[model samples]
Target: MRRAAALLLVLTSALALAACDRQAGPASPGDRGRLPLAEYDMPEDDVRVVGTARWTLAKECMVRLGFDRLRDLDIDPLPGWPRRPAGTGVVSLVVYASDDFRYGVQDPEQAARYGYQAARVDYERHYREKKWTLPEYLALTGEFVGDDPKSVHGHLVPKRGCLGEADRAIHGTVPQDRKDPVLDLGAESLEQGKRDRAWKKADRAWSACMRRAGHRYATPTDAASDPDRDREELEENLTDPEYDLNQPSAAEKKTATADARCKRRTGYVRTVHAVDVRIQNKLIASNRAKLEDQRRWNRDAARRARDILADRS
Candidate 1:
């Protein structure tokens, strides 16, 4: 039952995750952190407001359908909405607010503090602590009764549940199979950028730099993912049961710091950014119509969210 309820939570919020994985582009020292595809994606804060409104509407609908006890849960319905900078089991649900570490950890301070791990947030923990009842889950996820009508406490439930109804009210059903063009282009751009000769050259330089620093990694990504470290941790855990495998090790900190410095020294971030921007611009030009439609949808959703929030206030 717990497992089913968890699945319901995922289903309820799947629409929000379908949007985009946040905007990414080059940051030049101290700019507004704009990128080639930033204009096409909804700003992070707007996305948050929309999420809040959707949850608010869904919660209200739940009460109307007789789940009044939820009104006192006093827990945040939205967690990891805009994406936190650091956390365990990081899931990219929407566009993040900034370009910081989008191309990996560029900030030495952050690298020092977190190594390859993102700073932890309690989003996942919150969900685990607050479990929803099965009936509440059904109300949020719609009927599992096939084409037959379903009701809870004598009130009919929406086809897709209160969450789906709220989603439709804010996001609408235009472009039934909605797609996020900016996200598509951004992914394409990264692949194309990694293939660029300049990026390869910078990668080679970074690898050599890491080697000189006593850490041998073909790429910064490899160093961050660090399966080798994971293996070592697993082996060590057999002998010392107190070892927390997920925590950053001293070696990881050293490697991460070296990685940050090496990236700066080898101009890796700049190379990738330049290549990505070039590819992304070309992609945007080619997919202008799709992107425009996505932008239009985002604007409409944001407007509806604002009105909903305002009415609630």
Candidate 2:
């Protein structure tokens, strides 16, 4: 049941990321070096309004089904949206530079104050104790029915419960079948940037910097996933049974700090961003029709969401 609930949570989060939109203006001539606009990206205000409305509707549906305990549960912004830097009109290098850097331990001092392993311990412990019944979980996730056909409770569930109801109320239909062009474009652009000649030069510079610092890495990804850090973590776990495996150890912290400094010294971030934006702009130009269609769909969904919320109010 817990596993099923976790899967539902993952699905819901994915839906939010793919379906959510924000309003964006046309790119200025001076912004030619920036990442190309995906027509579907919504303004932050629209995202917040739509997100809150969906949460409210879901909560109301759950309450109608006699599940009131969920009223207190917090609904987080869609993944990647909250982390986006403002006014950049892009997910910038700062995302990898600040608190979110090196898997959320960007600063050694911050890591020391709040060890990595300790962050999610409370949430993990709470969920492990079986917080919700299987039926309740299914209903909340809009999959009220169990997967098995022979189950006794199979006939008692609705085809779509609270979450699906909320989606339908907002978008006329659940956007389960739609493909997210923005995510696809972002991945392709990043891969292209990695292979570009300019970025390769930057990677070599970063590698040299790391070598001078007594660490050898071919790329930023390689440096971030150094195996020595893993070995140290294993040793720590074996030596102290009470040690939290999730927490960043001293060795991991040292590696992360070095990795960050190398990134700065080599200007890898600027190099990659420039390459990525150039490649993405070309891709966007080639796929203009498809992207425009996606943008139209997103705008319609946003309108529906606004109307639904207003009617309720």
Candidate 3:
């Protein structure tokens, strides 16, 4: 579920990236290939550009307001935050947005190399590099103070501070609602995809293949999300005294490698992705009006954001 949540958030946030328009290019190649739903999702490069533009505007605002210390902070610093950092190589900060490894380690090479770990490892490290102080938090959010009595460094803090200023400049006064129909449909499609007969059959096949490979997980989720794994890892690492918990264990690598191989042998990725496509196509057909409205809002926001970024550049 956690893995799926990561991918789903990336998919839905594609709408958020639509705040700045740049038509996506060819779909990226990956284990799960490109699904039909990707036609509506923003490309990772566009998301990075738009996100960087937002971050740049906010940083400029902070510098102008004499808060240069906050310059290096990322705009969105949570897990699965999109936008690859400099020198991160092919590590995808957006996780498997372009691809579809939400079903687990679908790529044989990735599974053999990194096991179940994804970009979240590097992203979390980057996120932890900067801790937000109270002043920085206040400047970033502008939540506690009322309409008349908020001043920092003898200058009146604008409503929502630099972040709000940047947002308003790009997206105007429109509220970025979480209740988007497209996002709702995406969640629904994923949930429904799991219930599909083909999906279940593939899961069974994958499970049998895993058993043959000397693992006993009934589902990919079971293999990926075993609660005991973390506790056992902690116990094992406690004896070493120098273990990096972030690094995948030898056992994990072996298991994940097997999981990937089983998935490939059993056609799990293909089956589940097809199930999702069927489910999403139905949802999209039923919710065209709502989706269009969402897209229209995003297009307008994108135009504004693009112009603002261009001006700054």
Specify the highest-lDDT model's number: 1
What RMSD value applies to candidate 1? Answer: 7.8
Please write out the lDDT profile of model 1 over residues 74-98, one tens digit for every residue: 4254632222222222233221223
Q: Tell me, what's the RMSD of every candidate?
A: 7.8, 10.1, 8.1
User: In model 2, how large is the Cα lDDT of residue 92?
Assistant: 19
Q: Which stretches in model 3 have alpha-carbon errors above 4 Å?
A: 1-32, 69-99, 121-134, 141-161, 173-176, 239-241
Q: Evaluate model 3: give its TM-score.
A: 0.72
Model 2 bad stretches (over 4 Å) = 1-34, 71-135, 142-161, 172-176, 238-242
Candidate 2 whole-model C-alpha lDDT, 0 to 1: 0.52
User: Which runs of model 1 end up more than 4 angstroms from their true locations?
Assistant: 1-32, 64-66, 72-78, 81-99, 119-162, 173-177, 238-246
Clashing pairs in 1: 22-95, 86-118, 86-119, 87-119
lDDT values of the candidates? 0.63, 0.52, 0.60
Tens-digit lDDT string for candidate 3 (138-177): 5654533222236666666677666667667766642342
Q: Which candidate comes out best when scored by TM-score?
A: 3
Residue 84 lDDT in candidate 3: 21
lDDT string for model 2 (185-274, tens) is: 866887887888998998899789878988777886775556776776786588786885556677766656676666666666766767
